[model samples]
Target: MKNTILLLTLLFSVNAFADHSTSKFVWSGKCLNSNCTRSEIEAENKANYQKHLQHIQDLDAEQEEEDREWSRQHDEDQARADALPKYQYKPIPETDNCVTRFYEKASSIIGDNAKEYIDVEEIKSGKCIFGFKLMAEEMCEYFDSFSSMATPDWSEAEWCRYRSELREVYIQYSGLVGTSAFTDAVQAERKAKLKPVEDKHHKIYQNLYEQHLKQLKQ
Candidate 1:
């Protein structure tokens, strides 16, 4: 009986030790598995965040470029509006006949039978078509006459006369561009705005002409 009791005690001790070792092993494995899963979740989260940041940066850059372009266009538009003189002029010219005559001249330049999209009768009679072409020609001819009277070495008196003629032409032209009758105040404003610009252009042209003349003589 004493031997049997000893054997039973030994057996119980071995079984308890085996059970403890197995439970420890399983707990270690569970801990390692949980750590691995957490690490994978963290890596995925980091990659997604990085991608979201990159996408936001790209969007910001695009918006910045769009803003810059809009600013540039707005500035250019504002400058143009500010530079243009504010003046009133009539919508149409004093005479439609002048428009007709100008068109005839332009037609002659291209050919007697000018290939126009619209017929002359349609224009001259103020028919249901776009505006007449004669107004453009008349303006051109008027400018031509004004240019002929002015010269590179013109005296102040000649300059004054030329300036006056150009002013009148500008007034009429402005009426065509804007919907208002040409008023004295508007004519004065146009003259002020155009005289310097026109003078500069004419000076450049005269200089080129003189250079050409000298080269020809040489």
Candidate 2:
């Protein structure tokens, strides 16, 4: 009887130990070891979130800087273009035939070869004269002739504005091409005022040419 009682006691003890072990895991879901801590997981997630936010902010800053730089460059380009000369045409009688003659003369000079380079400096000279002279004449013809035919309702202010604009264009390109002379004869006639103007524009044109040459060599 004592032996059977001892055996029954041993079995009860084993079952009680198993029930106690399983009872410890009752769905509380808390980590039961030193390997994983709630605080450590929270810290890791917060750090990752902060890092991602910083990365997004950096990208936004870069894009804003790029946009600002593009705006600055675009404004600078617009300013340079605005500084270029314009043209203004005036009313003149029977200027059509004279314009045609100028065109014929100027068109024959501008070329696409080594001669163009050689002639670039001499463009205002008789050898390079016709190209730009004709260009000016044709422009005047179209603006003046067309305006007279279709726009009798045009105001004096409008005409003046047109003439001023056209003159500016002529001056700018004349500066560019140095095409002020009709011929040596015409040059001699206007040498007093023409020379100083040409001299000034020539300096600017030469500087631009030198810069272009430097870029090409580079």
lDDT (Cα, 0-100) at 131 in candidate 2: 22
Give the poorly placed runs of model 2, Cα more than 4 Å off: 1-35, 87-218
**How do the predictions measure up, each by TM-score?**
0.26, 0.26
Clash number for every model?
A: 6, 15
lDDT of 1 by residue, 81-155 (tens): 999989989688545553355455545654553324212333334331222232233323333432332221222
Q: Report the lDDT of model 2 for residue 77.
A: 99
Span of ten consecutive residues with least summed lDDT in model 2: 114-123
Highest lDDT: give the candidate number.
1
Candidate 1: segments with Cα more than 4 A from true spot: 1-36, 90-218
What is candidate 2's lDDT per residue for 91-185, written digit by digit as tens? Answer: 67543443334443333433223222211222222322212121233333334432332221213223344445545545643643445545676
lDDT at 81, model 2: 92
